[model samples]
Target: MSVRELVVLGSASAVPTRTRNHNGYLLRWDGRGLLFDPGEGTQRQMAHAGVSAHDVDWICVTHFHGDHCLGVPGVVQRIARDGVAHPVDAAFPASGTEYWRRLRHAAVFRDTDVIRERPITGAAARLDTGDAPFTLTARRLSHPVEAYGYRLEEPDGVTMLRGELAARGIQGPLVRRLQQEGRVVAPDGRTVTREECSVPRPGQKVAFVMDTGLCDAVHELAAEVDLLVIESTFLAEDSALASEYGHLTAAQAGRVAADCGVRRLVLTHISERYGAEDEPRFAEQAAAAYSGDIVLVQDLDRVDVPPRRRAR
Candidate 1:
């Protein structure tokens, strides 16, 4: 069975509090894992989340801020230390090439040669994931530093309708043949098309937006996605500070989710100033803007992507 969920390794912003860790998120899609914006304590946080270096197939860095990419050294070291057999790909802003190199070799550890660096530049760049089920792309976001958001799109597929299939007496290997060929010959020599027995299913989409102020790319990447994991570093009361630091408030994040038709919105990268008591305020402010489901993330929290929408 395939598992799909978001494992919140850490959700704190610039500073980690006693209850929250630094920024980190592991998106588990089917059998593959994509780790995003791993900060200082990601290595230990992964262990606590019951995930290992082997689970990480892709590392996406939104920016080089300490709260975003500080854990690269430890994560790279652990990937080498565990001798993970699969090749791990790392994507980040091309302008941060020097930072990427320094972090990869930050320490004098034996290199296992497992990581593949794919530096992203320009307004939008597609990362090559040869033969992967989904396509991954990065789009520039409006951050003080060079930053980018990530989006994943799966190809559209067809879902079999049991009622239609049974009505046509199609079953067993004939069902598979119908799916594979899009048409199957009936015993009466009639040509039955896949459309008669299946419904078109829209592909699943996910977006990761962090450390960005309001921008067109933010809306573009988030448009109609099933799940959007984004940074909400401040409450509405701190709108000025959020604007100065190029971060989003809970209300802004929620508005984006509502405007983009996001099904589930995950609010993370919470400021250190907010404590357990203030968590509810984030949800409340976001609720005031978006009617969709909103999740205020916590360390080690797992949120599953809601069921895929199918054509009626």
Candidate 2:
């Protein structure tokens, strides 16, 4: 069976606390694992989360902040050290090429030559991961540095209705023929069409928004997503501080989720200032705006994506 979930490796914002590490998230979708904004100590966090370097198919960096990209060197070296057979794609701001290079080669190690570079330069761009069922798109975010957010969308498909097929006396080979050719002649010589039995299955969408203030791109990337993982760096009382540092407050994150029709809101990258006792306040603040599911992430937490929406 295929798995789709978000594994929180670390969820601290600017600094690491006793309970929270730096910003790191691993999204397991089907057979592909996409690691986002791996911060300091990400390798150790990955080990604790039971994720191996071989499982990573893509590394997406939101910006070159030390708290976000400091672990890139260790992760890259680990990939080479383990000699992962598959190619790992790395995506980040094209303007941060020098920073990416510095981290990628911070230490000398065996060159596995398996890492593929994919830099995002424009206001928006799309990447084609060969053989992957989904398309990845990046949009510029409102941050002090060149930052980008990513979204993944699976292609829409049709779901076969077994009951409809059985009622039409279409079975075995006839079912396969109907699916392949979109039509088949039933045992009664009646023409059966695939559309008559199957219903439209809408594609699933997941978005990752990190270290960005309120902006159009934020709303665009989050619109109508099945799962939205966003940074809620501060509470509503610290809105000034959050705006100054290009981060979103809990209320803002909630508003975005409500406005964008996000089915699930995952609040991560929390500041250490909010101690364990204050965690509930953040969820309460967000709940004031969004009625959907709210998840205040912690280190090593696993959140499964909601099931795909069925056609009515």
Candidate 3:
């Protein structure tokens, strides 16, 4: 069975308290896995979340902040330790090439996986992995540094209609031939077009935004996404602090979701000040702003992507 879910490894913003770890998330989309913003202790956190280095197909870093990328060296070393033969593409801000290089060589082990440094330079650029089911798009976000958000879009599929199949008396070999050729002729002297029989199955989309203050780019990155994983580093009461630090409050993240028409909103990168008791208040604040499903993410929590919106 195929699966699409965000396995939250750690959700704390800057410093990790006893209750929370630093920022890290594992996106399991179909057969591929993408690791985003792996902060300290992510290697262990992955094990805690039932995620392995073998499962990671991509490592996407939004910026060079310690809380966003401190775990890269460890993760890279562990991937080598695990002996994963397949390549794992690493995407980050091209401006932070030095930081990524330091992390890439922090500690040396036998390099087994093909780790490619795919950097993002501007507002929008596509990362074509050549074999993955989805294509990645990186968009510039509003942060102090050259931060960017990542989006994944799967290829659209063609769904054939059963009624059209019977109407054309097309079966077995002819049906397969039509699917391959895009058109076929029936024995009854009728021509069947692929468009007449098949409907376009809209592709699934996931967006990841972190370490950015509330901005128009936030809405643009998350527009019409099936799942949006965003940072909510403060409560609504501390929104001022959030803005000063170039971060988002729970309410602000919710408001972006409400405005962008996102199907599911996941609130992460929490401040350590908030306890379990304090989470409800933030949730309530975000809920007030966002009508769609809201998730107050924690360490090891898994949030599933909602089904695609039916075609109008």
Candidate 4:
């Protein structure tokens, strides 16, 4: 019954278009909800997307840019107003501590004091999400500001083969015991091992690379990921502008996905200049490089993280 999907709240880059709102993304992994780069109007967008403040367990800000962190105040206040009982961890660049303080305390409200601050100061860091099945890591990204990208990796596990279990005449309680104990004694006095019936399941990986140009960290983060959600702020024709503004073009995003062996490439943070009619052009440009699934994301789009790869 676990659900893992990325809910796109908003997709605009520097400015909000008539149709597109500012940046906001929610990654729902099992029971944890990670809110990334919440920009202006994130609260309203979350409501529109049927997400509540109580659903957010962590808030990850890429940088202090207005389009990335402006919604912190409203989100924080909303969490307080709703009395979110659990502690919400907020991660951002350590250099932007002052900006975070201003945003967290922009207005006076009944503070629940449930928001915990964990600033990222190093080139790489791991976030401690207690009991979460995945490892969360952050890496520095190539941006004009002190920005970071995040990667989540699930641990490799074993998948029980029902056919193999049936062939061994194992059923009901015996199957559960075998799975829990890794081995179980059958009625015939023969020991059935989990390895005999289960195959290796390679963990699924998801990376979020926002507000960054091409860099070594970008490739490192995207490498071998099942899903890569990255910014495509411009097309190939506007490569110069993208480079100057510390953003990635659709072609560049595609190349990164291909080079890094990403299974699926999700291109978001689209600029307002590209109208609705021009959306397909972005996907076309990206498709030219990456052979995998390419998705040009829009507001409120939900992309599921594909299941783990099973052993052949």
Candidate 5:
């Protein structure tokens, strides 16, 4: 049983309140675990979310703001403290090399885990992780400092066709041959092509856009994504303030998701001022603009990705 879900590690904007921590999100895709933002208190937040540093295979930072990257030290330290033998890749802005270096060694404990840093300096970069199931792509976003949004794409899967197999009376080796060679000669002198048996299906995509104002790049990054996790730091009423601070309000985030064909939209990095009373209403306001699924994230909430739509 493979699992794909987003574990809300922390969901607070700018400052940590008594009920919320700064920004942090853990995306669990099958065997891969990706940690994003990792603001202050992320280490403890992970524990509260029932995830361990051993489960993290990738670390992504959207920017260098304290509320976004301040937890890097603790997360790195915890990985070492747990003695995770596997190396974890860390991706962030190449321009923030100094900041990355500072936090990486902020208060080093015994270094047991290998933290490989792949800095992003251009519009896009592809990370080859040997034989991982998915590939990671980082793109530039509209932010004050150097910021990048990360996207994960899984390779396409093979579609089995029982109709073609039955029509050709093919089984065992001949079925395998048809799949590998795109055509197989049947005992009855009939030829079966792979196109007759298989259908093209695009790989699943997940995008993370944080700490950015509404921009074309944000829509570009999230277009056609199966799951889009973005920051909705304010409500619809504060759209102006959100724009002034380079943040997205609920309405803007919802409109972006609807326009981009996102299957599921997760709104996170909320301000502490929005309490329990405001959560449902915020989601409602966003829903009024977008027809797609909307999730108002809270600390330690687990959101499963909606099932993929199949060809009718």
Candidate 6:
């Protein structure tokens, strides 16, 4: 069976607390692993989480913020060290190309051409993930520096009705033909259509919203997604500070989730001020708006993407 889960390597914000390291999340989708916002100490945190550099198929940087991307050099070096044969694609703000170049060669280490640079140029655009299972897109976010949010949308497919297939005496390769071609000829010289035997199954979607204030792009990226991993750098009580720093409050994250019809809201980029005792309050504040699942992520925690919704 395929595995789909978000591994939280580090969940702290600009500053690292005693427990929280920095912002790093590994989203494992089937055979691919997307590493997002590898902040300081992410190399160590990944080791602690039992994640190796070989597992990262893509590196997605929200911005050039130290807390969001300081560990790029280490992760890149490690990828080269491990001699990962697969090409690793990286996406970040086009404006930060210089910063990325510096980070890529931060130290004297063996470099490999396996790392491919894919910088975002427009305000909103589709990313080139190359024959991946899903379509990845990026949208500009409201932040002091150039930042972008990413969303992955899988194409919709049909869910074969087992009862209908059995009634039609379809099995084995015949079933595969029906699924692939949308129609198959039965042994009785009759035609079986996909619509007659299956329901439309909406494919799963996942979005990442990091280090941004409330914005239309935020909701647009998160619209109807199965999982939304967003930044909640402050509580509602500090809304002024949050607005000034271009970061979302827990309540804002919750409101976004509710407005976007998100299935699960995984809140990260938590401010260092909030300790273990205050972590529960993040969920409480988010619950004030969204009724769906909420997760105040902890270091090394793993949040599984919810199962696909029933076909309509």
Q: Please, what is the TM-score per model?
A: 0.97, 0.97, 0.94, 0.95, 0.94, 0.98
Whose lDDT is greatest here? 2
Please, what are the lDDT tens digits per residue for candidate 5 over residues 146-232?
788888888875675788688778788988888789898888988878778777667888999998887778888898999999988
**1-312, model 6: which lDDT tens digit per residue?**
898899999998999999888899999988899999999999999999999999999999999999999999999999999999998999999999999999989999888889999999788989888888888899999999999999988899989999999898888999999999989998887899988899999999999999988899999999999999999999889999999999999999999999999999999998988768888999999999999999988899999999999998
Worst 10 residues of 4 by lDDT: 303-312
Per-residue alpha-carbon lDDT of candidate 3 for residues 1-312, written as tens digits (9 for 90 to 100): 899999998989889978789999999988899999999999999988888999999999999999999999999998898888789999999999999999988975776647988988978889976888898888888888889998888877677788889888988898888888998998898888888887887788899999998777788889888899998889988878888889888888888888888889898888888888898876788888899898887799999989765643
* Candidate lDDT values, in order: 0.93, 0.94, 0.88, 0.92, 0.86, 0.93
Among the numbered candidates, top TM-score falls to 6
Ranking by lDDT: 2, 1, 6, 4, 3, 5
Q: How accurate is candidate 2 locally (lDDT)?
A: 0.94
Q: Provide the lDDT at 199 for model 5.
A: 76
Write one digit per residue (lDDT tens) for candidate 2, span 14-133: 899999999889999999999999999999999999999998999999999998999999999999989899999999999999999999999878877889999998999998689987
The number of residue pairs in model 2 that clash at the backbone is 0
Q: How close is candidate 6 to the true structure, as a TM-score?
A: 0.98
lDDT of 4 by residue, 69-110 (tens): 999999999999999999899999999999999999999898
Using alpha carbons, what is the TM-score of model 3? 0.94
Off by over 4 Å in 3: none
Candidate 4: residue 220 Cα off by (Å): 1.6
Task: Compose the digit string of candidate 1's lDDT tens values, residues 244-263.
Answer: 99999999999999999999
- Give me the runs in candidate 5 sitting further than 4 Å from their true place: 173-177, 187-189
